[model samples]
Target chain A: MDQALPELNNPPKTRRGARTVRKLLDAAQEEFGSKGFHEASVAGITSAAGTAQGTFYIYFASKEELFRTLVFDLGRRLRDFLTENVDETTDRLTAEAQGMEAFIRFVRLYPDLYRIVLEAQFVDPEAFRLYFQDFGAAYRARCEAAATRGEIRVQDADAESWALMGISLFLGLRYGIWEAERDPGPVVASVMDMIANGLKPRPGEGGTA
Target chain B: MDQALPELNNPPKTRRGARTVRKLLDAAQEEFGSKGFHEASVAGITSAAGTAQGTFYIYFASKEELFRTLVFDLGRRLRDFLTENVDETTDRLTAEAQGMEAFIRFVRLYPDLYRIVLEAQFVDPEAFRLYFQDFGAAYRARCEAAATRGEIRVQDADAESWALMGISLFLGLRYGIWEAERDPGPVVASVMDMIANGLKPRPGEGGTA
Candidate 1:
């Protein structure tokens, strides 16, 4: 309980107040997700939360603050979600396959996640940069750890981290956001094939070589 | 000049007029790149181009139209840039390495390119969608051709194209935009190594296995 949460920099003092803040966030997500940050109003958020407008001001100063807060909050939520979704298997390649598929599924579930994040570039470029920077930093650490444990090959884990994140991101943009309307199972499998085995055609693996 | 160009859908009739259009576009790039779409003004663009305010209306209907056009125009330029930079080498790996390094360099040179493209998502979602969609389709065709020619492995070229694009994109973001203050040579080299050899540790590689 004593642990400081940056997402909630202005911590709610009471347990009931914490719950109210949670309610506001949930309502804010849907509101901004549907209406976007520019069109989304604090009044709309409070209304959605079933709280009075004054109550909204009690916790936050303006809509801008809430949107930025929601970005970090969503970022944390996504990190936790992916960690939970990835298989517990020791093999990094296998985990990547599960992790990417799970990421796409997350985008589908949280349709507004991309919209909100993308809009952050326009609203607050710093927040947008930090979002990816934090994610990339954490991911790089994991890749390095996995490389040490021999779960993955020895490689430039920093570039690999960004590269892998890029793969998941574009796939999410295509399949999850664009409503690709195609089965991701084969798509993910194909990506895993490239990730697990290099793109160079092997002699016995259906290659003319 | 007879051939139609979508970015300049409203083509200037004479060579002189065409030059003016080019000037406006180039100036717009700097303007939007510096000011962003929302903050950017048509007057600012005209001022940058050294054209009269009335001349601005000769080609573009509004600032919005110019921004959209700039997005597509930039997309074309990037495609040309990457195509020109990728080596004539037959090996897919060689081409990829050359292509990725070139892509990163392009980002460094055209610092506003990513910002303009990202802003397109907010200004015109359809344009942003088409920008990547068109790129993915072209990239997929090339991947399939490379696979058929045995230049690369045969996998899901569709997913592979998106994955590759994602890699170049995020790398561009990290190295080009964020001012990493590090040479991209090593970053891109590491990615090339991963692309050439899978992440799995091999006997000869420095892995303890």
Candidate 2:
């Protein structure tokens, strides 16, 4: 799979080479995030990175390759961030709430996260699919472990993971990007409430506003 | 607002003109859906409609204009489909379940729905925002109504709406588009269970498999 993906086949062997690659990826994110994939150019990314035009080619074969690499890099970074923030020992519901809050904060810092991922659907369908699939797989594993430990109710981890992912993604889009003014505390609490107690009115509990 | 959108400013005055516009929009869907916005051509849309190239300009000013129009049109059509399919009388939980099931079914039929909507986030940010905003607003209204009637627990409708939308959209992307081989019934039931009962095991209810 790495061989099939030319972008991943070439890896920086030295510290200096890795620094250059990191700079290029950061510049590519800003370039692609602002101007989009179609309007973004190799020259623009190179200039933004303050690297020689030839330096970019040494790291990436083409602009398409760079974009795909950047996408993969972003997903890995995001997963790392989520993993570090969410405690594996916590119950599934607690983990979900913390994970959601962390995701929203991440999106707030990287406002271009959604734009770049969404653009991948058109510019690089395979990357877009892989990004989500990889995230879903990790999420499903965690859910399954939690279920086995009786930290959460027994359920289909596959479906549950996808549904939970949808909740976080949409919430990030709405509160993290679109309406940045709204407090995420209430939003997270409300969602976690539904995730914990559900929307059903408990017996003998009046639905009071 | 319609007047503000140049693409939507021009209205077909006669029944024949309206029919022609509809035909062009339908053809544009196929063209844009298959070829994407940048690669999709005016000639291809017209040809697909079985109409002369000049006739396209009568309805749309340019290919960009037509693409924007098509994105807006698809949103409206999808909103209409969800509205007509989701029974308003049902409680919020039931409505959510039915709506998710219907949306998945809709995507199965119109597999391009996610691609087009996701693409609009990059190609046309305003259209993409409006598409979600419009749906979120309507969803919030229903949620607010359900809360008032004591059918569901009281919560922040705005936040709830976005979360619910995220669930449906992501599920549609996962089950409807990527893993079409899987039955959506199980997916819908799993998600609905989460929404209704949540992940927390009830008191005295052993976490039985």
Candidate 3:
């Protein structure tokens, strides 16, 4: 999360410069998350970042560009974070729970993730599409590989990927953002139980246990 | 979808007045859907409805109120549509599939359903909150009843409700909105396959089928 803005179009030459850009991005997140994209101001972001208003020009052209960059940055960093958590060695079901737990953890750490990401849909539709498209592709690839490896079964990896992504998303909204105080362990277990075995009744398992 | 504005605050007394109100509401949907809430105007709505701008005030006071009314109107209509499709006597799994199909059908019919509902988050936060809260409550109740009736097994009905809702939401976005030309039959079947029997490898069944 503390990483510098290496992906910036105008790369920061000095370490101090990179730090300033990072500060502005972080401040922009808070501003945008709180006031939304239309209402958020560059001056507000700069002031929040503890930098002069002119300093924002050194990093972003306008509030919109800064928002686009922030949206992509969140997507990239979250992908990296989830990828690091669910290693290849774990079984698919285990990885599913682990991935969900990791996602919930990230959502908790970045309390504004939901608002910011959802706002991108209206602010920058392309970025919003790419965010989900990239995630869907990676998720589909994982599902396909798991199917190939005998770790899971699915009718369509593509559709299955969307379903799994939706589950993680809404669960993150509920257990992570809305009820951030709740322990994620039970939520993760319940979801994994449904994904691994489904809601179908098991033999001799009958009514409410 | 062509139902009259019986829920309007100032319900029209005459048949012609009812027609005018319904026209304004439908026109508001298109305007708000295309131009969004802020950019959308009462002028545009009245013009689209082929009525005088003064006619707008005859029913609703402001654009924000119209948007709010539209949001709740869509939700109520959609809920009614789904209720009509998924009857009380069906098995839980069958009902799940039926409900999803009904939802997809509704999404296709009201292509702006996603944008208007989503925009409510930014325009009318309270409305957005109530929309999901009410939907989540109904979904959770259904899950609890299903679990109690031995129609399904779930670790947590509340969490399961959110996950299932997410699946319906994203699937509607994909198959219903984005790929409107494609048949929803396959999407519904595949999702039901996943929900009814999860991704776990079945007994005597392994990799890639």
Strongest candidate by DockQ: 3
Supply DockQ values for each candidate: 0.55, 0.67, 0.72
Candidate 1: where is the Cα deviation over 4 Å? A1-6, A50-52, B1-6
Tell me the TM-score of each prediction against the true structure.
0.91, 0.92, 0.92
Q: Arrange candidates by DockQ, highest first: which order?
A: 3, 2, 1
- Which candidate, 1 or 2, would have the higher TM-score against the true structure? 2
Once superposed on the true structure, which residue ranges of model 2 sit more than 4 Å away at CA? A1-7, B1-7
Candidate 3 chain A has its poorest 10 consecutive residues by lDDT at: A1-10
Q: Model 3 clash pairs?
A: none
The RMSD of every model to the true structure, in order and in angstroms, is: 3.2, 3.9, 2.2
Residue B151 in model 1: lDDT: 73
Kindly give the number of clashing pairs for every candidate: 0, 0, 0
What DockQ does candidate 1 have relative to the true complex?
A: 0.55
lDDT by residue for model 2 (B6-106), tens: 24568877777777777887787788888888898888888988889988787778987787787776776677788889887778888888899989988
Model 3, backbone clash pairs (residues 3+ apart or across chains), number:
0
Error of 1 at A34 (Å): 3.3
Q: Give the CAPRI rating of model 1.
A: medium
Error of 3 at A128 (Å): 0.6
After the best TM-score superposition of candidate 1, give how far the Cα of residue A102 lies from its true spot, in angstroms: 0.7
Error of 2 at B177 (Å): 0.9
